[model samples]
Target: MAGSNFVSEIFLFPLSGKIAPILAMATEIKAEPAMVLAGVLLSLVAIYIASKAGGEFFNWLGFPPVLGELVGGVVIGISALNLVIFPENGVDSSASIIVKMLELTAGLAPDAAEVTFQAQSEVLEVLAEIGVIILLFEIGLESNIKDLMQVGVQSLVVATVGVTLPFVAGTAGMMGIFHVSAVPAIFAGAALTATSIGITSRVLTEINRLNTKEGQIILGAAVIDDVMGIIILAVVASLAKTGEVDIINAVYLIVSASVFLVGAVLLGRFFNDTFIFFAEKFKTRGRAVIPALTIALFMSYVGAAIHLEAILGAFAAGLVLDNLHETEVGRELEKLILPISDVLVPIFFVTVGAKTNLGVLNPAVPANREGLVIAIFLIVVAIVGKVACGFSVFGLGNVNRLAIGVGMVPRGEVGLVFAAVGSASGALSPALDVAIILMVIITTFLAPPLLRVVFGEGEPEAEEVPETSG
Candidate 1:
């Protein structure tokens, strides 16, 4: 009864009043700012421990470390340990071990627990958003525009086929067979379009096939897939936000994103010298990276200002900076950016895992049965649609069409980005979100071994190398 009253107070009153039950008989209280900060600090500890442990464990097991981070998040999140939780729907501070620890040790009054939890969760979410922006920026820096252009027609065909098949099939199936609403179906379809360049590239490099013909096509096609996936992501996210599509708005986003990408590339050629000169002039410690980040942030702002996703801007900035990446300054910039990525990027992945409720997959729950069926359907579509891209390769004799198709299979971190955005927008029901997440996990797990089998390679040589950061 008391817990119910507390929940009512939280819902009925403003934030300031929500913390008052202990301080006064009436519902009015001033929260300690220190308590909120304390909560954030504690949450970070949990996030980092989970991320590192999960990553190292997965890396040891010959899987992508990011997957381990995801599973780690699952272990610590609402679905498991409850070390890190959000105040979504029926969830409250009572379910959070972190909040409980705070209450026990930090003199955090019971009445203020909810407010502190809300504040901390908001901070973590901001960190996760920043993490993804940096992630796209890093992806841009690594992609070779010249090389991607060289692969040209074959890659373009593969990327187009890869994106189109999954999107058309997934969206149509969701609406026609499952009777899902259009926007959610579109978001789900968009999620299917992502081909994780990071995971694919790592597998190729490991098997000494990175320089092979099939590998080049796969890498180039994956880059193109990333770009297409981004555009699709921007479009679907917009659709999900509005809950109804306006043709004008959708077209505007598509045009604006294209112009923004092309314009940045063109404009970058003229400004490259000026950028270097300005960057070199700085005597400060963060000279190289600071200017680069400024560009990324400015572009991100422009993307948001134009009602496109901010990630589009950051990605464009990375492409603009790609030319400079080979220089001494660029090497330094890469070294610097990596450590930052190591710290923040996992937050994004883990948070996505944490938000996921695997409970929805339980067959014992009557409502979940539909979600399970949809998940199976999505898994099949995710595989078949991407594998079909291999058969689309034309005019190349003895090209391993199977390898190229399997290479495009893993959704990796890119798929997670779609899932996160969709879930955040309230566009996906819990069941549907979990379904998408399951598809991502299955695809990510299957692709490496499947790639090895198709390429006829033995186990990868044991060597330490930096994993791709997409």
Candidate 2:
């Protein structure tokens, strides 16, 4: 009975002062049926606010706003301040959101809390998944299919080498040094497979060097890197789900992923023309952006249908678009997609942050001390792996090797997605999960500042080395 009252106190009121006093009082005494609904609403509102505030603060401090979002989650999450109890384990009161909710119900029913958590988790997953799809789709919109091929032979080599090195180091380090199981190690390596183009490109743009050969190479490599990472993600995700990585199944995944990406871009061309034709006709009838969004959603399903990741389909859909800016309808569709992406994308990041159990990093705790060590090792591999890409170029002409490498260091959103996939796939152990999250946070925090310093004004530029086919 005491526990029940304690739970009610936590949930029945707002966490920070977002609500009026009157509303808080009324919500606390609301009848039984309305209790659950109020709790969910409170969670959503609190999470979103925390996420936005975190993002803004990080952005102001010269870091990616996403880092702030993750911080916000940690601050409210049980791992840090314990301000909010989105518990990691229900049996242990320390981590269960459901157990907290159960306290509010008069009967102290675990079933009620369990049911609510399952429902809430499902909804958040769908929404988070959608946000990631939109994120990849936005990345795709930045270039045409030809851009993938246009990243010079050197860029392609760099991307390939970059991804290969990290996977090997991550897997070997986890197994040998950390004594981790193979599956979890594979997930760790897979998480490091992509460079955050958003971070790298921003620094280049800020310094007016985006068009430089070094910058171009980084951009090209980033694109190829994302494709490689997503394909790897699909394969590893399959391995985690099946509990065994069959050779035949691995080959099949590779083939399917490749075909899906290439085929989608090719087929999407025809669909784009057809879509535009109809969109133009219906422009006056207010059916403008439907075709664009519908295609993206449809392709997302197609990806999952064929055993490829849904983001791959969303990417394919974005590639299918021919820059809908020529016609009125096309212009409208572009505007419509951005706002939707903005709204949905933050929810995913905030949730990822909130789920990170920071308590695992405490050196005073024996198990967590080990986790901190693993996190440090993983962080090293993630940085060195991508930084090595700077050297993959055969010709170095005025390219600052350190800058190019540092630019690739930020894992950003993609790493978050990879970790989320592992968690949802039930492939990650709690220790491993915390390690990956730490890696993500560190990488995300490091890149922007490093890039600004490396490429800051008046820095001496290295002379370009003549091109050689490596």
Candidate 3:
């Protein structure tokens, strides 16, 4: 708590002077509408650019770009550089910034400005939420539904063992060994269970082992990991909202999420011809991608309508369109979705990064030590837990146990998605959120080099057909 408190005050004091005058001046301005739009646009640009810079820097270092984006977001966030809207101390953050803007433009007193600011922040939060949903949506599109069928029993065994071991180990380690409470512990465990299909598959593709037995197992297991992780997320989200997990509630979420996922995919497949027919009728190139985008949004909304995360619905939507890859409609849809994903997904990651209040990491404050220790503990579990999955890859030809194990290690986007929803639903406290992100950061960076060792680095023949991120 001390470290958390210390961090909050760092930016709070500077904000009082720097931001208040801008608000007051903006309040005095006659052009209120233009200013608000300008303010929002400026904020959006800053977020994207900062995120990109961080992502690229990390990429150059041989780590995943998303990892850098998260780190960049934290650096520019209100906690550190006051780059984002909200500050930890709750002094001169979003609400107050809004208050000043309104006061200058609307000529209201401090109180009125503050109230209006609160309302605006809720909208920004929703935007940030949607960003992540779209992210998972794109990830789902990359992994797709057909991946589940290609690899067979060996992959299933690897996936099942891979998923189960990490989860149990994470849960048990937190609750039994660390004396943590169950709800948070469950979430902490859930975070450890995800594997980054996009990153893993890309590595395998690079090594030209994608068609190999071990490669199939790794990719298939990663896909299974994503699906299982999403269901677990739904369960944890329900508990986060209620401040605890209940057996009946958990059961309902699991069943409902499972049913919705299967139903969405099946319904989409059954109607795929109709969708293509409707899509084909369109003459305007400008509007061609709408049908696919519409289905994605519709599915996402339905998932939320049933109390599951919109991401689950989005994932299913992608699965339904899995075969669209070879069609004109698929090409058009990809053109539309990839840009949207590229723009919005970084916002989601940065927001997750912004959630960290680095005060907890300050050495002067003893409480930060707890966060650091827990993070280290979780990182160890994330590695060992995934490494253990290599043992389950039975009946495979020339399997690199180390390679499969290393491939499963990076949590990447999926881990961040889990962390975001958990934080949003109140499953993770601020400290725990930072801890999860730290684990993601470490494992994401560690996985690539270790994988290179197992596969050996050199260009291989280009894949005839790129494997799905799965």
Pick the TM-score winner: 1
Question: What does the lDDT read for residue 314 in candidate 2?
Answer: 74
Off by over 4 Å in 2: 1-40, 78-111, 152-155, 174-191, 194-245, 284-286, 394-404, 412-434, 448-470
Instruction: Give lDDT per model, in order.
Output: 0.76, 0.67, 0.66
- Candidate 1's C-alpha runs over 4 A off are 1-31, 88-90, 172-191, 194-245, 395-404, 410-434, 444-470
**Backbone atom clashes (below 3 Å) for every candidate:** 0, 8, 7
TM-score of each: 0.78, 0.73, 0.72
The TM-score of candidate 1 is 0.78
Candidate 2 lDDT over residue span 153-258, tens digit each = 8778888888999999999999898888888899999998877665455446555555456666777677668767756776676577666544554465567667
Question: Model 2 TM-score?
Answer: 0.73
Ten residues in sequence with the least summed lDDT for candidate 3: 2-11
Q: Give per-residue CA lDDT, model 1, range 365-421, as digits (tens).
A: 876777788889898999999999988989867678888899999997689778877
**Which 10 residues in a row give candidate 2 its minimum summed lDDT?**
9-18
> Clashing residue pairs in candidate 1, if any?
none
Model 3, CA-based lDDT: 0.66
For every candidate structure, what is the RMSD over all alpha carbons to the true structure, in angstroms? 8.0, 10.1, 8.4
